[model samples]
Target: MTATTVDMEVRGPWSLATGRAFWEGFAPAALPAARGDDLTTVLLVEADWSRAEASVAQDGGTAAITVDGDGDLDAAAAQVARFLALDVDATFWPAVGERDPVIAEVQAGLPGLRPCGFHSPYEAAAWAVLSQRIRIPQAATLRSQLTDRHGDRGAFPAPAVLRGLELDLPGRKAEYLRAVADAALDGLLDGLALRSVPPEEAIRLVQQVKGIGPFAAELVVVRGANAPDAVPHHERRLDDEITARYGDGATVDSVSAAWRPFRTWAAVHLRAAREGRLHEFG
Candidate 1:
């Protein structure tokens, strides 16, 4: 089988926040590789051998993507193009009104905020389950380890591959992985199948996993399945960021109230803030 690779740039009136959000959620690692230090408004694709890498440099106003695999290059490029097109639409824009002062401030400073969604429910669920109640860096580390240990070496693991893997980690980490593995084996953690189910059912299905709770389950629904209105409760990092920014008065309802229909956007902004992209919002 022959493999093909292609590179393309997505162009438009661009926003850094939107670009980062889309790339981070969809093609996390590739964004850095393709764009380097340039702000990407375009998507770059390199595809071969049934695998692909996508890159975006928001500062350069372009995204670089690569696809490789035993498949049609055009089809892979189309998929990359679809993801890039979504970022340019209002679907990814965070709705902000003048009513709330803080949101108004955020909007006034950074007018390009947008609403973005995830493409893979299974990956989202797995990420959410692994991220529960941990620091972002720590969670990322654990996820890397999980992928390295139980997942396929070059590509992400299939859900079936994770089903019965014996995960060895130190102490509590090991316990958590085993629990997730058990859920996968028992068919209780079917994120791909649950995508077709209603949000409520999907939440129920994911929560049946040992370590997954309402918070993690809801996050999977929102961040994984792209259920736009799914609100995440019990997210400690979110709460902490609110407190640090707005002080003790940053109650969940208070901090998130202004976001209304665009709470997910707010969540993404908080995440960006953590990543030292606070200037991106402005």
Candidate 2:
């Protein structure tokens, strides 16, 4: 495959955040080759835009990502650029006002958050299903294991690769992988539709897989599929953060009120706090 260079700038507050962390979490092997002081490699997972690597460059203002061996690099780049520019409104951000000061502080700390534009809904849904009832680190580890077991050896596994594998998920995770793998093999998983479907329908389809419930489905839709309205319902840490900030009565609705238009921003803030990005509330 000939490598194509697609140069484009991502717009929106969420784009910056996505550029910073999503790739690190989702695709760890696709390291960008460092070129000069300012240009570094950005890896793009095949057919997915939710994550990309940030290879630093000497120039500073622009970062270059190289998508090699992937088909239609230009087209993929264009799609990514489009996703970054997507506009999300207040309705998408859950109502967080009247909840507690801690929630407000977390929200205020991180101002940039947005949905990751993932092209494959089935893959995202599968991840969500596997992640259910587990800690983030645990879930991430499980995903890494799955990739090693069933995904391709490159940046990310190709759907063809996922479709061909017989996954061995040890313990409870085994059951979940079986269901997701079955769906992928059966042609019931619609990669295109996931990128275009209504949020409700997307959630419904994703939940059909065993081990996937409302919360898991929503995470895939919101974080993976870029559904603007998706909010995590089962994250205890988020709840704890909210409670510590606002007390025991803090609901997702009340805590999310202040970030009307940018609820994703609040989510981003929470994630940053977890990663120790901001030392103290500003």
Candidate 3:
């Protein structure tokens, strides 16, 4: 197929480096190809999928993600936007920082870093199972194997396409992915399904699946749904990181109040800071 290219402006604060790092942070093989400031990925926007190459560069206060692809140019551009988290409302940063002093310090260093996430909540849920209880590298290998064997076109399998397939991961992980794929195909785990209730209740709904747990459900909410206020607190409520800052780990939900409407974004940056370093997964 002939390749087509398009360009879209990524408004607000953004950095190509942090975007690429977030993409490759969890697993490189599952994400796009990042060379310097350029990124390339096969994306699924709605029904159409495209193998798109993009160059993210500064444009005054904004950035431009120029996309070249063999599939629908418009769809590819939207996918690129979703993958890089370009459409998020970052105007809440100022209010968030003012609400809490500690977040202000962390936000100072981690500008232009959005969630940097998966294509959709369904994709996030599938990945959560594949990577469950395993290191990222292992998850990448498993994801690659599944994609190569079953994906119609692109680096990751589509919901309907993956529903009929299976993987060799431990226990019911593979089956769980297929189940969620079915749910995705049925739109049972879409944004509305998750957002219909509060984040915590949504976690319970997600845990209805065979393999998903509290941590994985939280992941689905943040990464899959790109939920602004949601934090993966199931895995981290009293870690030294929050206690050191807020002086009360028990009040994590209250502590996160300061980062209201952007906790997912803050959580990612805060975790990276807590690690003491940001290693490029690329």
- What TM-score, computed on C-alpha atoms, does each candidate reach? 0.61, 0.65, 0.81
The numbered model that scores best in lDDT is 3
Pick by lDDT: 1 or 3, better one: 3
| Residue-level lDDT for 238 in candidate 1 | 68
User: Which regions of candidate 3 are displaced past 4 Å?
Assistant: 1-11, 28-33, 48-55, 66-73, 152-154, 191-205, 248-250, 276-282
Rank candidates by TM-score, best first: 3, 2, 1
Q: Per-residue alpha-carbon lDDT of model 2 for 1-282, expressed as tens digits?
A: 555555443243333543434433433122233323332333334344223433221122233444444455654554444334233433333345334345356545544334343434455666665555665466656666765664445234555555456665545665665576576556445544554676668778878878777877766566555554445676665666666555788766776656544554565456546544433211
Residue-by-residue lDDT tens digits, candidate 1, 1-282: 343444444343346555554455433222322434433322112122133433334434444444444455565555444433432334323344444555555544444644333334444555665555565566667666665665444444555556556665444544555565555555554433554577667888788766677877776566654543345676776677778777887766776766655566566556555444442211
TM-score of 2: 0.65
Better of 1 and 2 by TM-score: 2
The lDDT, on a scale of 0 to 1, for candidate 3 is 0.66
lDDT sort, best first: 3, 1, 2
lDDT of 3 by residue, 72-110 (tens): 766656555665667665766667778777778877776
lDDT against the true structure, per candidate, is: 0.51, 0.50, 0.66
